[model samples]
Target: MSSFDYNSSMIKAAFFDLDETLINAEHAHKAATEKAFAVFGYDYSEERKKSPNHISMGKRVYDNLKARRDGAGISEEQMPMDKLLDIREGYFLSFMKDEIVLLEGAREILEVMKRKHIITAIVSSGTKKYVELVMDIFKLRNDIHFIITGDDVERGKPDPECYLKAYDQALNELKDLHNQECIVFEDTESGITAGKKAGMRVVYIPTSTSVPPINYLPDYTIGSLLSFKTEVLI
Candidate 1:
């Protein structure tokens, strides 16, 4: 067997991805997407719902509407930006209300991290309102130290903006802590990439849908957050 070098540095702060990572709410997102698509008089099928490409389903629907507006032989008039916004908001609100559920071991892991005095935060591609709603519904509002949502940055996950913002928040909250001591917990490939690019160690926990295969491995990977023992931090 080959010997491997392990980094002995202890983590001081922890950032988590909100959707599908700490909360299993992709189904809510899918339901919202389907409802949004219906506003354009397009019905999404169960087959489309089951497709792996459903991760980009929202963007696809938006693009389709824009394409229709461009005409170029298509008869539909240009959809007002405000109308599109309404459709998106309506669908999200309809699906997210009382539908958010925390993943198994999520609350326990967060409690454990808090007990260890780790600064905990949420960094997500989701809108701040949505993230806040989920946190409130799941009773995690008082547990986390901060949240960096999509509206806080110009770009989303896989861009590093959100994670970097989250790190800044953590740094401010933990004034004496070094940036390298921060760790991120993610369930999606985009989130993991962003965390790593932000110079943070990442712990990946896969969800049932949308999470890409790990082409670039995270600092740690486990089936559940409960498997993350305190010894790993020490």
Candidate 2:
């Protein structure tokens, strides 16, 4: 029931993380990984169910493929980085088509933010294409003010680059607003860390399962986006 007054002219923008925060796409990631594994004739269902710390699933898959190629004595000339990227992109697209789903209150929360005229943007560790797919699925492309994806930054979440990029984008979009006026909504530990590191007030929304322990507690924590209210906007 905690609330904050947002009527003050100071607060202006709200930054959000996509996966697990604004959109429930972890399931999609797993499905994508499984499909990607299938392309290599490897089944990952057993590992997928038991593992909760596979944040860099795409990179992991790429590394696995690289290791296999090396073991087979494939020349470096044969396995170019572009080819690897293409394979990952193909698998991710397949996963998006088959398994992406938005979290239950995402549309409502976003609508409320828009009604309030709060500048909103998505800052996610996911690739640009994957994030866009989810946004399209949720019909949230136009609703969001901006987006900062993995491809936009040199470092991903937990490093502050993504949030910084989003903050910069928001500042450009909401030119009248100051940096301190922005806030962030996140679910994963890395996402929260990134937001906090960027000096924005953060609200944590834990997922139903696989809630990672946050090293730095967020300004606030909620069980779901459904619990977010205007009172907490400050």
Off by over 4 Å in 2: 1-10, 46-85, 232-234
Number of backbone-clashing residue pairs for each candidate, in the order shown: 0, 1
RMSD each, Å: 4.6, 4.6
Superposed Cα deviation of residue 173, candidate 1 (Å): 2.2
lDDT for each residue of candidate 2 in 23-135, tens digit (9 for 90 to 100): 65566556655565455555556444333443542232344344444544444675564565576678667767566667777888888888888888887766777778777
TM-score to native of every candidate shown: 0.81, 0.78
Write the residue-wise lDDT of candidate 1 on 70-95 in tens digits.
43232345346457656876777677
Residue 79 error, candidate 1, Å: 5.3
**Model 2: how far is 122 from its true place, Å?**
0.8
Scored by Cα lDDT, where does model 1 land? 0.69
Candidate 1 displacement at residue 96 in angstroms: 2.2
